[model samples]
Target: MRRLRIIGIGAGNPDHLTLQAVAALNTLDVVFLPDKGSEKGALRALREEICRRHVTRPDIRMVPLAVPKRAEAGNDYRGAVDDWHAALAEAYERLFRDHLAEGETGGLLVWGDPALYDSTLRIVEAVCARGLALDYDVIPGISSVQALAASHRLVLNGIGESVLVTTGRRLAQEGFPQNAGSVVAMLDGEQAFAAIDPAGLEIWWGAYLGAETEILASGPLAEVSEEIRRRRAEARAAHGWIMDTYLLRRSR
Candidate 1:
C-alpha cells in the first residue's frame, strides 16, 4: 500500500511550519509540488523553500505536477465547481498511478491548513474515491485567518460572541451577518466587502500575511475600504496573484 502525507506549509512563511510538518517533509520519498503556471510561481517557490530549509533526507525527489485551471464559473456555479474537481481528480489519479510506486510515501504541501479554504483535501478524497489504494495523514499549519488576526493584534471573537466564516459571494449578497460577532470572508476574489454596507463595521485585512510582501490595514470599514481595495490591486499587480482574508467585527 502506498502512503501519502498532506502537509500544510502555512501562509507563505517557512517559519510557520510546525515540527510535525517539518518531520513529514523529511520523511517523504517524493514531494509532489503543483505547478499552477508561471503566474503563481511564488507559491511553488515557497514549497521548495520549505523543503530546502527543513528536509534533511538525502536524495528526496521533488516532482512537479501541472495543475489544471478551473473554467469560468458561468451561471451554474455548483456544476462548474464539480466539473473542475472532476478534472483535478482525473489529473491526480494519473499523477499518482504513473509517478508513485507501491510502498512509496509521497508528500503534498498545502498553502494553508488543509481543513480551511483549500480544495486539496477534497481533491485527494476524490482521487481516493476513484479507487486509488492510498492512505493519508494531515498536518495542520497556520491559516490566513489566524495570521490576519495576529497581524492586526486582535482576537476573532468578543466575550463569547460567535464567528462566521463565509465566502465573499455570500457576504456580498446577505450583507453582514445579523448575530455574528466577527465575519471572516475567504476566497474573496470579487472584493465583496466593498459592495456591502460598512456601517458599524471594523475590519482587519491582511494580504500576503507572514511574508516579506505582507500588507495590512485596519480601521472603521467605511474609512479603509478603499485603501484595502487599492492595496489589494497593487499587491496583485506586483505578485501576479494574491491570497488574502479579512475579518469584520461589529462595532459596539
Candidate 2:
C-alpha cells in the first residue's frame, strides 16, 4: 500500500515545472529518476535541478535508476517493447521496496506529460499488474507538441480541421495519411519525414525545444528538407545528443 505521484517536468526548461509539480516534489518520501547511461543527462539533470530548487532537504529520497536498453532481439517490434516494459517495472518495484515506505508517498518525474508519448505511465502500470496495490496521481505538464506549436506561433489545429500526432516511425512507414493535415512527428530518430513527398508540406522543427541549445527551423519542406537534416546532424554532433520534434502541415 503505497501512493505514487507521477509528475510531468515539462520538456527541458526549468520554467516548465508547474506549481503543482513543485508542491508534489516538496512532499514526496522518494523520487525515482531514470538514467539513460549516457552523457546526455539533460533530462536527469533537469529533474535533479527541480528537486534542488523546490525541496530543501525535503525528506525526499532521490533514486537514480538505470534504464535497460531496448531489445533488438528479433523482428517483433511490439514484443521487444513489451519485454522492456516488464523489465522496467521490475526495476521500479525493487526501488520502491528498497527505498520507499509502505503506504508512503513517492514521486516519478516524467518528461512532458505522462499521457503523451511518454512511457512512465506504462512502467507504473506494469508495477500495478504485479498486484502491488498503489494509487497514482498524475499532474499534467506542457507537452513538447504544444511547445513546438507555440514556438512557431502556429495553432496546432485550424478552425475546423483536425490534427494528427504521430511518431517518426509511422510517419516514415505509413506515409502521410490520406487527406490528413497538420501532423506532429516526435521521437523520430530516423528523420522519418524524408519518406513523405516534401511537396506542399511545410515543416517546423526544433531540437531541445526549450533549452538554451535549441535550434528552430521552418519553411517549405522541399526547400529546407536538406537544411533540416544538416542542422539536425550538426546539433547532434555539437551536443553529443539531441531531442527534436517537428510539425508538418499539408497547407491551409
Candidate 3:
C-alpha cells in the first residue's frame, strides 16, 4: 500500500511552506496537483511554484489531476459533501493507479492546514475505504486562522475567553455564538457579518489573503462592513475567484 502525505502550504504564499513541508515535498515520489481548470488554477500554480523552488530533483514527477465540480445538494449538506468526497477519492485512486506503486510516497499540497475546514482528509478516508491499506501522514502548516491573526495583529481569543470558528452559513442561520468572545468565519460566499449586531463589534477582513493582490479592511463593523462587501465584489470580479477569511470580536 502506498502512503499518502497531505502537506499544508499555507495561504498562497511560497514562504509559508515551512522547512518540514519542504522536506516532505522533496521526499514524495509524486506530487498530485489538483487543477480546477482556469477558474482556480492559481492554487495549482502556487503549488507548482513551491515545487519548482524546493524540489531539487529534475526527475521528480508532478501530476496535474482534474478536480470534479461538486454537485449541489438541496438539503442534507453533510450528506452532499460526503458524496462529493467519495467522488474525489475515486478520482484520486484512479490518478494513483498509473503513478504509484505499492509503498510509494504520494503528496498533495493542501491549501492551509488539512484539519481545518478542508475536505482532503475526508477524501483520503474514502480512498482508504476502497480496500487500500494506507499509511497517512499530515504536515501541518500556517492556516488562514494564523493569516487572519497575523494580518490584524490580534490574538484569536481574549485573555480568558473562548473562541469559536465557524462557517458563514452557520453564522448567518444562527447568530453570534453564545459565550464566545471571538469568532473566525471562513468559506462565506455571503457577507454574514451584516446579520450580527454591529454595536461594539470589530471586524478584521482580508481577501485573496497572502497573495500579491491581497486586500484587507478592518475597523468597527458599522463603519467597514459595507466597504468590505463592496471591495470583495470588485476583487472577485477582477480576479475571477477569491479566497478570504475574517475575524469578528465583540467589545466586552
Candidate 4:
C-alpha cells in the first residue's frame, strides 16, 4: 500500500512550516507541487522555498503537477467545481501511479491548513473513490484566518461570541450571518465587502500574508473599504495574482 501525507505549509511563510511538517517532508520520497498556471507562479515558488529551507534530505525529488483550470463561473457553479475536481482526481491518479512507487511515502504541501477553504482533502477522497489504494494523513499548519488576525493583532471573536468562516459569494448573497459576531471571508475574488453597509462594522484585511509582499488594511469599513479595494487592485496588477482574507466584525 502507498502512503500519502497532506502537509500544511502555512500562509506564504517558510517559518510557518511546523516541526511535524518538516519531518513529514524529510520522509517523503516525492513532493507533489501543483502549478496553478503562470499567474500563480509565486505560490509555487513559495512551496519550493519551503522544501529548500526545511527538507534537509538532498535526494528527495520534487514533482511539478500541472493543475487543470476550473470552468468559468456560470449558473451551475457546483457542477463546474465537480467537473474540475474530477479532472484533478484523474491527474492525481496518474501522478501517483507513474511517479510514486507502492509502499513509498509521497507528500503534497498545501498552503495554509488543509481543513480550511482547501480542496486537497476532497480531491484525495475523490482519488480514493476512483479505486486508488492509499493511506493518508493530514498535518495541520497555520491558516490564513490566523495569519490575518495575527497581522491585525486581534482575536477572531469577541468575548463569548461565535465566528463564521464563509466565502465571498455567500457574503454577497446572504448579506451577513445574523448570529455570527465575526465573519471571516476567504476565496473572495469579488471584493464582496464593497456590497455591504460599512456602518458599525470594523474590518481587518490582509493580502499575500506572511510574505515580504504582504499588505494589511483595517479600521471602519466605510473608511477603509475603498482603500483596500484600491490596494488590492494595485497589488494584483503588480503581482499577477493575489491571495487575501478578511474578518468583518459587527458592533455589539
Q: What is the TM-score (0 to 1) of candidate 4?
A: 0.97
Clashes of 2: 0
lDDT of 4 by residue, 105-222 (tens): 9999888999998889999999999999999999999999999988899989899999999999999888767789999999898989989878888889999999899899988899
C-alpha lDDT score of every prediction, in listed order: 0.88, 0.84, 0.86, 0.90
Task: Arrange candidates, best TM-score first.
Answer: 4, 1, 2, 3
Q: What's the candidate order when arranged by decreasing lDDT?
A: 4, 1, 3, 2
Q: Once superposed on the true structure, which residue ranges of model 3 sit more than 4 Å away at CA?
A: 37-39
TM-score, candidate number 3:
0.95
RMSD of each: 1.3, 1.4, 1.4, 1.2
Q: Work out the TM-score per prediction.
A: 0.96, 0.96, 0.95, 0.97
Residue 231 displacement in candidate 4 (angstroms): 1.2
Which candidate do you rate higher for TM-score, 1 or 3? 1
lDDT of 1 by residue, 36-121 (tens): 74436778778878887888988898888888988888889889989989999999889888878999999999987898977888
By lDDT, is 2 or 3 better?
Answer: 3
Question: Candidate 4: where are CA atoms >4 Å away?
Answer: 37-39
Model 3 residue-pair collision total = 0
Distance from true location, Cα of 92 in model 4, Å: 0.4
Query: In candidate 4, what residue range of length 10 has the lowest lDDT sum?
Result: 37-46
Candidate 4 or 3, higher lDDT: 4
